[model samples]
Target chain A: MTELEIIRLYRSGQQEKAFNLIVENYSERLYWHVRRFVCSHEDTDDLLQEIFVKVWKHLPSFRGDSRLYTWLYRIATNETLNFLHKEKIRASLKFERLSVEMEEKIDDDPYFNGDELQKELLKAIQRLPEKQRIVFTMRYFEDLSYEDLSEILDTSVGALKASYHFAAKKIRTELKKSSIQL
Target chain B: MGKDILDDLKRNPYSVPDGYFDRLKGRLNEIAVSSVDTVPRSLWQRIRPYAALAACFAASFLIGNAILRKTAPGASSSDQFYKELMYSDLIPVTQPYAIFEMEDEEEMETSDEDIINFLIETGVSVELIAYVELLED
Candidate 1:
């Protein structure tokens, strides 16, 4: 269904149809986006569900100001930032808290095969500043245009291009150092 | 120069764990059922600001009415004064006898020409004329 139809269904209280449309339209795309930011499958799973829940709650406020995908990406970006911020705060309060959760989630995640190269790439991504990482993931992995990235990140096209460039450079260097191809 | 890196990143699409979306759909359904009570929580959220605004408007109306009621009597009296001034020309001389008596005495004492000449020669102010009339009364 078109975004308008989906919105109409949602506003008409047919939330099931609306959510089904969301799943059909964006599940895989959003999964990849979430996966890029988070390391393990369990974390991505948790974050993905939370992102959709947030989307469901806030969809009424969307107002069609931007494209549906851009709006969704903006939500994803915010959730990821919040997740990172909370993790940082928790770590500061007790350093072991983040590590323990990370270890448990990583160990328990069935989808995580823990390939050395993927691990290295994730570690490199974790080191990036949030904006660069988001830009890079959107541009490289999600294949979003500069315009869409700008809307999602609320950054200028030039700045987003620069961020992506720097992110790629960092990732390439990290991959090389770890002797991981591509 | 670094197009190759970007290309590689693009080519190697990230794989999600199998059945992630299906599981997510189930989890969402679970949340939806469990969150029926939480749904009303948002109803309160939506109503909160409007309720506050309604209270403010009601308070303002009451305060305005109170202030108006407090000052209404004074305002009405001032309005009466202005109304009297507007219709002053229509005010009837209630005691015509007194006015006729005053006019006759003044006419006997002085001719109109004498009064005019006195006014011209002395350059008597209107206030003096009013005072003389008052003294005669």
Candidate 2:
């Protein structure tokens, strides 16, 4: 169903149908958005469920102030950051350092099927500061407009552009140093 | 070099575990049910610290009772029962959980890199952040 149809269904008291449409419409996009930030398939799976749950809970109050997908992305992004925040805390508390944890997870991840360059590229992206990493993924990979990103991030357009520019520069340094070509 | 990096990075090198997207809706629906039970979750969160304190008190009480019983004159059958209760309650489950939490609390540290990098500009003022938070609640 279209976004409009989902909205209509929701406003008309068919909440389940409306929510299912939301899941159908944005689940994959939100999953990828989450996956890039978290960098672990298992973590992404768990976070995706949490994201959708938040979406379901908040859909009733969704006033169409912005696009539906944008709102969903905001929720997805916030939840991903929150999840990563807790994970960083958890890792430190247990003496399982994050850098070490990421190394082990990358090695053990069943879904990391990329070749060496691709793997290196992901590692480079991983090394980007968390917010820059997010900006890089959404801008460079997802091709979202700065206007849209600013809406979701609640940041100025110029700041986002600067972020992506610096992110690309950092990523380029990593790729060039590793001799990983496009 | 810049263009080359963008081109490579945009190649979409990631993949989810098999059947991940296919099963996503089902999984989401299941979680949504639990999240909707907001009352229970908030109640539990509010009471969690109290619950932990209560558990500690119970543990200490049992230990103290056992120590007194050990020192007192003719040990009754009830002494054996109380000793058994303390051993059963403290050793296998409660003690380990408390120890784990204690260790976790002690080691709660944050990485410097994480603090340095969380620099996304949220253009809202502190008051707006507080206001939005209020509206959210």
Candidate closest to the true structure, highest DockQ: 2
Query: Which lDDT tens digits does candidate 1 get at residues B19-105?
Result: 767877777655545654464557878899999999999999999999997655445557666455445544457854543453436
Tens digits of lDDT, candidate 2, A63-148: 99988878999999999889878988999899776656775677677777676776777777777787788888899878899999
Model 2: runs farther than 4 Å from truth?
A94-97, A180-182, B1-3, B31-137
Best by lDDT: 2
lDDT of 2 at B100: 46
**TM-score, per-candidate, Cα-based:** 0.58, 0.65
**The best candidate in terms of TM-score:** 2
List each candidate's DockQ score.
0.12, 0.34
For model 1, what is the alpha-carbon lDDT of residue B71? 59
> At residue B89, what lDDT does model 2 achieve?
49
Candidate 2 to truth, TM: 0.65
Off by over 4 Å in 1: A11-13, A95-110, A113-115, A180-182, B1-6, B9-18, B30-137
